[model samples]
Target: MKRLGLILLLLIGGFSVKASYKQDTTIVEFTDRGVKKRVTVYTSSKKDFELPRNLNLENVLRSMGVDSSERKKALVLIEQNGAKQDTILLLANDGRTVKIVAKDARDQLSRRDTLRNDSDHWSRSGRNNDDDEDDDDTTTYVKPKKKNSGGRFFSKSDFGFYLGLNNWANGASTVPSLQTWGSRFIALSFRRNATLINGKQMDLALSYGPEISWNNFMFEGNDYIDRSTEQVEFLVATKDLNKSKLVETSLNLPVMFNFGFEEAKLKIGIGGYVGYRVGSYRKLKYSDSRRKEINRDNFGLNDFRYGLTVEIGRRRGISFFGRYDMGDLFKSGQKNAAGLQAWTIGIRL
Candidate 1:
């Protein structure tokens, strides 16, 4: 009984001394539009001074020369960082300075080690764990477990844009008069990729996607695709023209098989695509006051075409892609640009 009394007296004396030292520690609390909130702020003020518990929020803000909106924002900041050591408000006292810090600014080991089955958890300094030492802030060792029996999805998906150059490919001759710079190719593609063969040295993946592509073949000078001659002919206009081109849009499905070199951080893929022409037209812009003219027609272009695609880049990021048409760009019996096929090279995002 005598020993218990002595321990109680010592604990009470320690608490009293601590309270005396903390009496001058003015904490800046947060108040939101007349509603009192709890946000602890340690301030560096004069040792003899003690801030009031219910300081007039409006008057205190007015003295700081802050407007009404700013006061609301400050309150919001405090509210968002509730019960956290958000920051320090420094009053002119000695050589003290304010310090702003994160609320749960515990050591970094408190974070979860997110990996496969070997993920180990770390406990914070003050957190009570099931271990023998309640105050130990060390990492809790976790044994590695067997991989999941069901397995994980080899999932990777993307929606990306491609922009670059376009041209025609034919075995007989070339459309050399086409403007290289103005013949722009654009495509929008959405794809899902999955691991086909996951191995130690290399990995293989299969990607299948839907693509919408546009080809603009801006011809040079007066050259235009003339459909009125019963065939698609790139004829020079007699009327000094300003602009002439043929536009084709298609909906395509592309399938690619990719090989990934893990250490090299490179992925190379080859595949094929099949597409149907959705829309086609020819436009003529006159230099004089004849006004811009547009003709909506197939212009002897084939309705369906299949092509080969090749991709190269990192597994995920801006990559390079190229496609070449294996079928005719024009119908087989069209007699004009019949063998011309479309091919494009561009960067994919």
Candidate 2:
């Protein structure tokens, strides 16, 4: 009777042990938004609790009640045993589905080594046969890092120089012949760019800032820019028209809408600018004695200038720009120059 009793007791003990091993499970609990969610992960054996090799992180996120649209901005914290890892969900490079990307910690261990160490620790803990007791290991939770959105605002600044061919249009009379090579316009600007729409493959931006524009109109005829009368008068000089030039300077405010395409390889900007005249003057050179004269006067130029501006080119490469003034070049007092307007076209550097 004693021998029979001992055999039955051993069988009962073996069955209890097997049932306990089969009941081992891992419960993961987290909060998404304001809702609480829980998931149960079953282990294949008591000695090992491994997630499936083809586990889909996106599906896990969805199961946790995360909204599909908000998933891209969501961060996931995974804790196993005592080790913790932070991951972010992102669209795959092919743009077909979502994937997990580990936010690397500052530890010196390689990713493979870290994961291996974690698995080894869990395996060792399981072999100790302490499944019924609560684990004393401290739970580590990794916090997500903040991202820089860099939206359209005071985020970035740019500086550039522009050189353009200058010309003038007159409706009352024939346009004066100009020294095309010497007639030039130049501008220097400091612009602040704000991103309006930051798309995955393209970006739309707006830039506005202070600019200084200088217009130099070189004439072929022997003419003098008369500030007193606000008009040009023919001059009789022993020497031919060696040099006849009128210069105008203004402080301008330019705003532009920029479209960047092909990963910013190509860019186009269309905008307008308004400026207030700051200074004006005339310079003349005589051929007989090669004498030069500088007259610092308003030269009857308009007090304000406004224009339409355009730019197109490769990013950080040579670009072409054009500006057509809508305001008259000279004030209304000049009879024949009532419809005179200035325009420029050139390359930017």
Candidate 3:
């Protein structure tokens, strides 16, 4: 199952493109009041391009005498070409004046059938030289390229943390699961992934965090005590208390399978998580000496739980998500085991 998830994640992560280049160009096509236009420009290689600052399409059209009304309604098309290419801009209106320049020898010749005699003569001589050398070096040779995964889909993600308000319900309000109670708790978590198995899109990961929670409960086997009536019944009284606050810290391991659409920019996935409670905060806090609160540290909490997780993200930068704990956090007979289920809301970071 874990291997399956790892495969899913890697497969989903494989589609996003990440390449480095120094130069690029922008191609723009515009239609103003039914007029079509196009232009291209070449630029120096750089990591990022500043929009408008480098080339102002609006200003260019205005300089060409295009009317203000036509400019406002113009439909624009923009394409990012690598630094090696020229930025292309087009304006259909006669009002707009566009400066056209040749990017290379081919571009210069594209508009004319005229050929440079010297270049043609030089090409013929070069071809003759190539034929003589080709036979001399009969060893068909090629340079080998370095094999690298390169930084593709995800290099890293941001940290995420969240809490759920309605975790459980019982009698009057009970949630589906081992425990039941209307409660609120917070889950602070950190997640990371690794591609362990080959030929699969599943990823293995770890997440752990602490939580603070509050809930009401009636202890098993104890005489029911009603603080409202200031009465302790020997046989039928029910144990009644306002609420209890507890702390839980756990370590979780989850295996997930992911699937992506449109180059892994959009994704959806489902997986399961296993957890171990490393610490707990269950001691009661009281302000007065007249009514002493009891501690059930030795009787409650199983310390282990498991659940399923759903994830979605747009590359490694932006993600939104949720998680649900499906397993019990109690031993067979612990008193506090009655309430331990939790929920989480955090980012993919």
TM-score against truth, every candidate: 0.57, 0.56, 0.41
User: Candidate 1, clashing residue pairs?
Assistant: none
Task: Quantify all predictions' global Cα lDDT against the true fold.
Answer: 0.61, 0.59, 0.36
TM-score, cand. 1 vs. native: 0.57
lDDT of 1: 0.61
Give the alpha carbon lDDT tens digit for every residue of 1-349 in model 3: 8546534543442221111011121112212112212232212122222122112345434433446664453322222222222322223344122222213232333211242221211000111121221232322222211111222222223245443443432211221231233334444454443333222222332222333222233222322222222221113324433333444556666556654432224555577777776665443333333344554342245577777878787644545666667765454443323444556554544
Ranked by TM-score, top first: 1, 2, 3
Task: Estimate, for each residue in 290-349, the C-alpha lDDT of model 2 and write its tens digit.
Answer: 679899987667899999999999866788999999989888886656788999999988
lDDT accuracy of residue 344 in candidate 3: 57
Q: What is candidate 1's CA lDDT for residue 216?
A: 95
Residue 258 displacement in candidate 2 (angstroms) = 0.9
Output the worst ten-in-a-row residue range by lDDT, candidate 1.
144-153
